[model samples]
Target: MADTFHDTDALVAALSDADLDRPPALVANAHITGVSVARALSAHDVPVIALDRTDSGVAPPSDAVDYAGQVTYPLDDADGFRADVERIAGALAFEPVAFACMDEWVRGFAETEPAGVRLPFSDLAGVERVLDKANLYALCEELGVPYPETYEVGETDADEIVERLAFPFVVKPAHKRKFEEAFGTNVIEVEDRGEFEDVVAEAEEYGATVLAQERVNVAVGADTSLASYVPPESADRDPLAVVGNAAVRYPEFGSSCLVERVEEPAVREHALTVLEETGYHGISESEFVYDADREEYVLLDVNTRPWKWISMPVAAGANLPMAAYADAVAEEEYEAEAATDGPRDGRWVYLPDYVRRCLTDEAFWDVLSEDDWRSLFSGEFEREGELTTGLYRPSDPAPAVRYLTGEFTDREYYCSC
Candidate 1:
């Protein structure tokens, strides 16, 4: 059968066919973050239609997309967005399989759950807890997990806060996503109380609830991310998860560009413990920075959706997203198997971002401990090997072609972020 087809019935038949161990049908918004989820599904022969919010036309992440609209939260009309989503899915004759790329998108989908659409994430309340930094850190304390020491303030003033904590500390939003957009930074460092007060004042101006915490030096340890799937309680099974050690990332407080699958028992144990405490049965990413001073991995943040590099795990022979997708849409209970000893040497690399950082930011490239400079110089970043490069797939040339035009010839639309 031709991969591209018209008529809703033909598409439905292709999606619903059981003989084809195809990947789950999906509806995800487009971004570099969602690229991994889309690629993972496409590799499985799953029929996926990424929902592009920018409507810039389909990139590789949006390769199979049919609908394009604004998916922003609190800005776009919520009910209208849902209507548009449902209309598009109905026209395509597809039931949304399990996957969400952004937290705001997740909440939007859950709030107005369109007909035939399903998101493989926690309940709305669970999502709130994960999105709220204060709530998550409190949960960590309850679970006896080692989280960064947070300093709460009655006001946005920082004079006393500075005296109480270390001189160079980090202050960020109690609710991260909101603050990230408002401040353009995930975490801000203040050398003195004056800068702290100014940063906090600016944060308050944006109506953000800010929190101050000790900046545990990540000078020695690796910056790691743990992707996990805790199935709904009905499954009564253990959660399946994967850990990646970052080789190169964008900002000290941002997404990874180069990473490799690793087996960190302590990191795994803490993540599972938190999942068990919350009884969370959904997809989550727990970020930890190896604090050399403490000789342990300190929990930094927990993301309750498909992260920026989520596709890498799938490339390394693990399909946590598939487990959630299968469980969400299938009649039978889905038991996710743990990814094994295979692909240990494999690395997930996004060529564009890696090279971008190397040219623009010395601070990030200077901290490349787990990666070889020579390999990155040669565009061969993977320790085992570069498993994948950006969204540059042989079958999908449009995104790469689009990428090149802006990257080289035209700098106006270049995606630096």
Candidate 2:
């Protein structure tokens, strides 16, 4: 990794000076997923420029990153973010493919449609249409996909909302990126009518549209995500897809700390249907939560980026970042090979979090299955390859060491799922 550039101008100058044969891929948000993106593309012999807004995360020390820089504006600032993208792109001789690793970056990139950069996903309008959860839920309903029963706080009356949904409902933003920026958390669970009303007031104050959604019990079942990619030209073709489930997610309602690749054909089928229906063209993860009561999987948010456990698919022999890159740069439209889940499914564990949980949570082992323990002990998961786990790689050990000893020790460790 190069010395971090504090501003876009210096970063662009450095990028121009290094003028290589091929255009470098730009990875936004140099966190865990960004590091994985750099590794995936660099392994394919593509040059990479990794960018981030904050210096707190693990990507700064990763060997996989060729160029590391800091952007002045936060991802929510569309104008500032767009200006920075243009600055970086204008300096490079060849057109760079821009990859947004987090939701806010996805929103910024999708909305801006930077002049000189090539986006891995669809055009601005198509990308924006799918990113908003409100539109996603409506599309799910049109396609007969199962999602949690939800009422928009702004559109529906407060009394009607409480009457329609059960107690212990969730209050969340229809547009997640903005809400996360405002509140620093994704979803707020409200236990009673007073709490729900208070949350609605809070959301209104921040100019965010909150939704009252029926709470699905994740304690009984797993959180599943259909990580997939659909080519730009061939929307009709079946997506490169893999199903992964969170065996353990800390905070109960928060992000998955440990995910295992599993065979969920139903998840694949549903995700494919959603992708095809939307005419979505790019890498995406369709998240689902198992509703034990309904004995069905309920559709949640659809992330239009490289997700946290993206390396799991790459390690399982389906490299989405490579596929997206090839499609963007190739003369002809790139067709991805058939997606494989490997002989044994892969595991993606955030080692620091997993280790911390073992020390702190006594019931952690009780939740995981015998097969999960066996696979971990036998090293079957590690056999798939280097990018399978987050932060730790024998080939590139510094990031893990820094993360474990520095960020995690200070309790400042944060990864946007």
Per-candidate count of clashing residue pairs (backbone under 3 Å) = 0, 0
The residue pairs that clash in candidate 1, if any, are none
Model 1: per-residue Cα lDDT at residue 122: 75
Q: Model 1, poorest ten-residue lDDT window?
A: 1-10
Top TM-score model: 2
Instruction: Give the Cα-based TM-score of candidate 2 against the true structure.
Output: 0.89
For every candidate, C-alpha RMSD to the true structure in Å? 5.2, 3.2
Compared with the true structure, what per-residue lDDT tens digits does model 1 show for residues 1-417?
Answer: 122422333444433342333334444555555556665655545666555445332343245433223333323677866765565455443456746676667777767777767667777777777777888788888988888888665553456677678888888888766677677777888788788778777777777888999989785328887877788887675677778888676654455777877888889899888777766678888888888788888898887887767767666666777778767866645444335654344566666767677788766444444455555545454324546555555455566665676556534421232
TM-score of each: 0.80, 0.89
lDDT values, one for every candidate: 0.65, 0.76
Give the local distance difference test score of model 2: 0.76
